[model samples]
Structure formats: structure tokens, C-alpha cells
Target: MSLPSVLLRLVASLAFATLASSLSHAQSGEPGCRPEMAGHRLPIQRVQLAKDEVRLTFVGHATFLIETPGGVKIATDYNDYVRPPVTPDIATMNKAHSTHNSRRPDPAIKQVLPGWDPAGKGAAHHDVTLGDVRVRNVPTNIRSYEGGTDYDGNSIFVFEIGDLCIAHLGHLHHPLEPGHLRALGRVDIVLFPVDGSYTLDQEGMLEVLKSLQARVMIPMHFFGGGTLNRFLARTQELWPVERREQPTITLSKAALPTKPTMIVLPGH
Candidate 1:
């Protein structure tokens, strides 16, 4: 079957299940799950933009708190373990894996969005905007164990802030197909896993980067040892690596690299 056809079937099944669950709850005198928010709208908070600074705090692994030029604070994969965990204006989570999704997050957050929540009733298409930044989700597959089918419903998200479009490949287990590439659109920076266990291996990740042609690549989810070095070595042949002194770095759209580059930040 075609990718669109497969997507349609998955969406249909989800809708039917949601409706059935709602009816079952109605009969049981319990409120059914509230239909997902229209357009899966997330609450937005405003901030005052400083002169030229775009502060980004790397909250360990795939989690990042980005403060955009217009003062919008956005968090990606806001799991619980981030040391010095930050309370941002918005947080995005993917429900695929436990480590990347949290039901209990910092209460100070203004809006919390799951990456798969759709707008207008169909399976959600990822496109959210807050202040001067835009956030999108790209669906992909997760390989299943026991010879089961792959979980194609999984998503990898991308956030477009100012002039930079950063993509977080959430627990991606496979290389990108052509359709996945088209859905991802443009990516300025990429946060990828190099662990080679739970996610795509180092070689698979390299293929993904080449296909996306992102300006900068940030490696995450490495379990220490030489795994990170292996990932770096593979990419260094094609892209320059900038090992940073701090756990976090700041960037503007204009400061983003033109050729593919790797930025290795300190982690907990």
C-alpha cells in the first residue's frame, strides 16, 4: 500500500476507537476522553525579546528549552530527568517511548502538547505557531519486537524558530523514506540519537542527516563510552564538528551554519 493509504487506515482506526471509547464511557456514566483540543492548540505565552540573543538551554538528552528572538520559550521532549529542569512557556512530548513523554511536567509551563495530537478531528497534522516561531511534527515508524509490524504512527518533531528550523528525531528506529523527507520540509539543525540501541544506529543516523541536509547536527542519547566519538567521526568526514565548552549554546538564524556542521554540547 502507498504511504498515504497506510496513514489513512491508521487514522481511521484511531478515529473509530476514539468514538467507541467515547460511547462506552457515556454508557458507563463517566466523561469520555475529551476530544483533543481543536487544531490541538497549545497555550501561548509572551516574552520580551532582548536585543540579539536567542538563548537555548540543553536540558540533557533530547530535551531543549529554546528562547526565540521574539521571547517565546519552547521545550522539546521535556522528560522528567533533565537536571536543573526548566519550566518553559511550552513543552512538546512524543508518546512513543516512556523517556520522551511525561504525564507530570513542570506546572509553570503555559502549554503542553503531545506531538501526535491532531487538529479538526482527523489524525493530527503537526503545525503549531507561537509568537515568531513555528513547530511541526513528522510521523515515522518504530520497529516492533516479536516480528510484529512497525509502529508507523510514531512521530519525529521539528521546530522552526525565527530563521532556524530544528528537528528532533524522537526514538527513530529506521531511515527516512522519500515521503518522510517531504513531510519534514526544511531543517536547519537536527537533534539525533547516536546510542545505536534504542534508536537508529550511528550509520542510519548519518543517512538521515545526508537526506535532510541540515546545517547543524547535534548528537543526543549517547550512553557515553566511544559511541559519541564514533558518531562524530562518521559525520566529521562530511561535516565540521564544534565541541562546545558549555552544556548550552545560543544562536540566531543568521548565525546558523551554511554547510553541514556538528555542535557537541556538554551533558550531565
Candidate 2:
């Protein structure tokens, strides 16, 4: 059945609206599921990192709390609007958008870093150790917007805990140029954005993924349902897709994938 042009446009608009509304509800800390959403409840589990056991908790969107192998707590893109407002030993925020950065973090946090600042001083790059885990940040750019750069000062973070090297791509807009790739070096696992508009689209993201050649690919920033499905479909042809029962997956040096694998986690 051929659909009318007007109807197709209407459907597209409605889909975008629905996605925007769902994000709004998440930001507002509203209770209840957004339409067509599934896997909102993260099946919590524990994974061994080195000699220690780490517990991972997903706090919706890009927010995640990680208890290091040595028991130090760390959080990425901490947002209070998400349920259970996370408090961690270290928190990182990207200034690109309100959704990725917060004005204030939990009072209990030991360190808080912003990805960008007004003077373009660049996202504060730092290295710290928590128990046995080590973390570092490398500054990167978001695509230019409105004749200016939005969060061009953002940073992509690398966390080395136990035998794992995890990279978090925060609203990355451009493909990694040669220099950028060199700086990233080796990444065992990657957390990336698959939604087309805000970050790299499916094609661009695939390019980045191929460039990184990380052992495990974990997709984030997708706006639920078919958005995620499309990403999985595109990548599955090249990599095995693993549907994890929980938002948090733990790995020691042992359980890592020998072949490239894409892991999808539930987001509230």
C-alpha cells in the first residue's frame, strides 16, 4: 500500500515529537514508560574486574554509576532528573547540552569535571585513580553549529580499570581523523551514540566503529524502539549483537569478546 506524501511527513514529525517528548519526561523525572519503550528496567548484575567485583548501575540516558574493582564509585554524565539521582566518587559532564551536563552534582561527589567552558579553555583534562582503577580524559570536538561550535571543547574519556580499557564518546559529531584516532589508541570497549541527529548517524558511527576496532561495542543515546533496532540491524551484519539482560555488564580481562561484538543495554 502506497502511503500519501502528506501522511508520511506527518508520521515522521510525530515520531520525532514522540522521541523529544520521551526525553523530556526522562529529564523531568516523570514516572511511567514512554510509548513503545521496552527494556526500561536494567537487570542488575555483577562482573569481575581483576581481583575485584564491580557493580554497574544505569541511571537512564547516558548516566551510569560504576563501582570500581577496588570499590571506588564513578559516574558519567550524571543527571539528577533521572531516577535514583546518582552520587558517585567521580562524575563527568559534557557541556554540549543540558541533557549531558548538569549545573550541580551530588554534594557527596569527590570530583566533578565539565567537558567545556565559555572561554574555550577546553574540557578540563584530568587523570585520577580510584582504588585500582585509573581514568583519563581527551578533549574532542562536536560538529560546528549555528556558525559556531557547540561543545567543541567536549572530551572523550578513557577508563582503565583492572584489565579493561573503556571509552565513552560524548556526543561525538565528526569521524575520528588520523590524529584523533592516534590519541584514542586502544579501546577494549566503547560507549557510543547511534542516534543520527545529535551525534553521528548510522553510517558515520559505523565508520568510527571500524576505525576504533574495539572488541566490544556498546551503543548509547538511541531514543528507544526502532532507533535502537536500526542501529543493531546496521551493525549486526558486521558484528555479533549480544542482548544483555542488564544495563550494566562487567568484564575482567577474561570474559572479553574475541571477535567484535555489539552489546545493547536497557535505558529508562
Compose the digit string of candidate 1's lDDT tens values, residues 1-268. 8999999999999999999997787655455323321211234343555545566666677777778777777877776555223357778775435667676877877777776543323233657787777777876656676655455445787777756777888778889998888888888778888898878777888899899998878888887748888778777678899989886677766777878889888762
C-alpha lDDT of residue 127 in model 2: 82
For the record, the alpha-carbon RMSD of candidate 2 to the native fold, in angstroms, is 14.3
Instruction: List TM-scores for all candidates, in order.
Output: 0.74, 0.77
Residues 33-131, candidate 2: write the lDDT tens digits: 543222333343444455734455655677667677676777777654543333467877754567787666667878776766656664566788766
- C-alpha root-mean-square deviation, candidate 1: 18.9
Candidate maximizing lDDT: 2
Model 1: lDDT equals 0.72
